[model samples]
Target: MTSISASEGCEKGLAPGHFAPETAYLDTASAGLPPAEAVTAITSALTAASRGTATVGGYFEAAADARARFARLVGVAPGRVAISASAAVHTGLIAQSLPAGSEVLVADGDFASLVNPFHVRPDLRVRTVPLERLADGVRPGTALVAVSAVQSADGRLADLDRIAAAARAHGARTLVDASQSAGWLPLDAGAYDFTLVVGYKWLLAPKGTSFLVVPEDLGGLTPVFAGWVAGEDPWGSCYGQVTRLADCARRFDETPAFFSYVGARHSLALVEELGVERIGRHDVALADRFRAGLADLGRTPVPAPGSAIVAVPGLGTAAGRLAAAGVRVSSRAGGLRAAFHLYNTAADVDRLLEVIAGT
Candidate 1:
């Protein structure tokens, strides 16, 4: 069980003045609220792009700088990270690059983005289990062990360190979907072999944006669908000539939705300014608050920590009644799930607990 320390709520992040949007948003695990500074940065970038600043001067170059900024926020070298239109784009490319006749291990709780690619590939073999059991499922021939760093529905945090240790013992690589844990997970990028994360969830970036980090020593891994954008010298040909595929992170692609990049870059900057550790603590604390309040109502709640996600056993009751009463939550595994983000406060949890009791 993850325990959150309540005494650490200090005002040390992007500055409260920069955190606009007075509305209380409790669904950050789904989509985070962007900070005001990041919004301004994105808006300025978009405005300049519309005026042909990007196309006339240097297309994607500015975006590249933004990707570098994002890499810094996530604790990965800029060269090892690929900026993309969405998290799935990076994962799909990796999935397509799997070796012939390779079997992959996945946790049953993976996000749809990670599972769908395997479904489309008939040649690939996939095995799903509870996340705790995923590392044990890895075998000598297993090409990859993919699972979310944090469970999406219930905020059940995963032990990636243990999973990583298990994969290496079996000669398998690991791909972590940090979409649920990126902005909040306690570990640095160096801790995982490969990680895919999106700006929409934890970073509070706009939709249609994210990044992927592939280690410098990819161990012969190559993206089968590598495009011109992924090149190290995308335009080294000097005139309409192609450059070699980038040895670093750019290998993911060259051209992406620049507007989305701008949005994500802005969001990431806010996360960095706030300090990843601080932001993580804020959400973890809120989750603890929610669980405490819910427990007071005699509700069964999962207390595990790592991410802001928390779960309440449905207790064989319909979850709709609670949702209908101004409570924002989801029903999964015959239970109710509540996620916390910067926008959520202890009051939100208290209100949710009150509603659950009346239901």
Candidate 2:
């Protein structure tokens, strides 16, 4: 609606100088491009490690910093956050901790990271429900409800508030996979018993870094299988000495990749500086324009209100054409899944539109 276009938003955040000019990558749902600051921090940490300048104390400090930043990003105390290698690991841990014969409700077609964990748990009964009916599906038998904050394939934003409220009323714990939404939208960890995030997707961090939020009261659901690092004193616990593990969420944090934490810390800090609200605005603006352009081409995109991912029909062919033209995109839900992020611009949207129109 405004004459002032898209690329202008990039100026207020990190400049897009880090990305190659020839390509317009719109697949943040798969992985995010780390900011220059994050890359620099990772490089420095690697150099220090190679030179034998990195100390155990430094590693702990960086990990703590990343934990605190991720906690802030999700509106939780640092003690409530646990670092993990991937969302799937934390998902499996939570799924395994549920009592035997517990009933779990999950939305059908959610990314495998959210549902696969429950599948392997023969003791738990997993029900696949419609995404829109998740709230209505909460029944007396449902012990847990797992959902993605935003559907990765079609960008359908889940009504997490309604689902969480319903789960609470039904005495069910709520777990939300925020892999595609955490860094792009506002999230309240207090709203759910557990929140899983993958750093490589929307957090602009390396693949090895991920976060899981477990409120203090939920600490009773301890890790089903813990590594030596999960104890308070890794060395002492390993040497046949019984020791207390951390009372907080750190009990689930095994030996983490410290270098990935360094990069994630820097990236999270940059996101905080830029402001998540502003980033959401920038992303939605570009996505809205892209959707509008699709409409102009007689193509109706899948509805994803207030979401950054836009989907349109013939996605596979369109993605192929776009990639051949040096414009990167993804195909999902029988449509082209173009995800706009802090790094994208109006020019990128225009290029995608042009390619689609030409095809």
Candidate 3:
């Protein structure tokens, strides 16, 4: 079996000491372990807050800094990114913007946060297609095509390039949920009309931080949830109706989560320093190692080439046993879901394999 050495697994800025020594954590698909820098930043923020030294201005600044860093990571202008508390909130904004009776195309079994808003609208026509046929399912009447860049249930990769092209041909807008792909996958937020990402899963930020990217024209989305923070000058516009909304995507912003952003700034900085391309290579290598071990044990995971997530059918019940044995993973869609990231190594994969073998 191929092995990735400790030196190869541990990037310069990301050390093994960043995580707990006893846990073989392969659950990055659920939530990432924040690096030491992020932990320190959050702790310092909390300390200041306790002493009443934490300023709202400082919090906003940290959020802005994190926003800029995220924009750079996803290859979009900062002006196009809107900060929100969750992907579902941003997805609702898009769903609200669509005209009643407009058709929305989505992949079958896509994350509920991405598909639920449209389904609940009642006035919209929501169509589900197999992920492999998502692009071909587009038609002239389709108002939007929404999908995840990587499937959360089975780690299947969506064909973004094809979907984007098809959407353009049909004059339909595109919304991509990159919550599962952002940290380890190289992405261009500019490729779609709308892109949504929740930071906790892969970007390593706290739960309340999320981002939405919209076209320069705001992609005709109405800022239904706009509040004081969405005003041209938030502090100045707090009392009355927002006399003027921000000219850019900030008009879609929710009030920033101060503490979350404090940690997010540092976490995103670490991601930038390590670089996405390098992280992608490292993550996939470990995932492939896991896949090889699974094959040796006569288990075949859902086919996801070049992906860092592996989901094995009929092994969902093993999750509890694996976790008790100190190997952390998730059970999703009646399968065992193991996600590898920058911090995972060959030893972690082997540890999971050993646990699975015993089970």
Candidate 1, 108-166: lDDT as tens digits: 86788877787678888888888778767777888788888888767777777888888
Error of 2 at 346 (Å): 0.4
Candidate 3: residue pairs that collide: none
List the lowest-lDDT window of 10 residues for candidate 3: 4-13
Supply the global lDDT for candidate 3.
Answer: 0.91
lDDT of each: 0.70, 0.84, 0.91
The RMSD (Cα, Å) of candidate 2 is 2.8
> What is the alpha-carbon RMSD of candidate 1 to the true structure?
3.8
Q: What TM value does model 1 have?
A: 0.86
Candidate 3 clash figure, as a count = 0
CA error at residue 26 for candidate 3, angstroms = 0.6
- By lDDT rank, best first, the candidates go 3, 2, 1
Task: Order candidates by TM-score, high to low.
Answer: 3, 2, 1
Better of 1 and 3 by TM-score: 3
For candidate 2, the 10 contiguous residues with the lowest summed lDDT are: 1-10
Clashing pairs in 1: 79-249, 155-309, 229-253, 229-254, 230-253, 231-246, 232-245, 232-246
TM-score of every model versus the real structure: 0.86, 0.93, 0.96
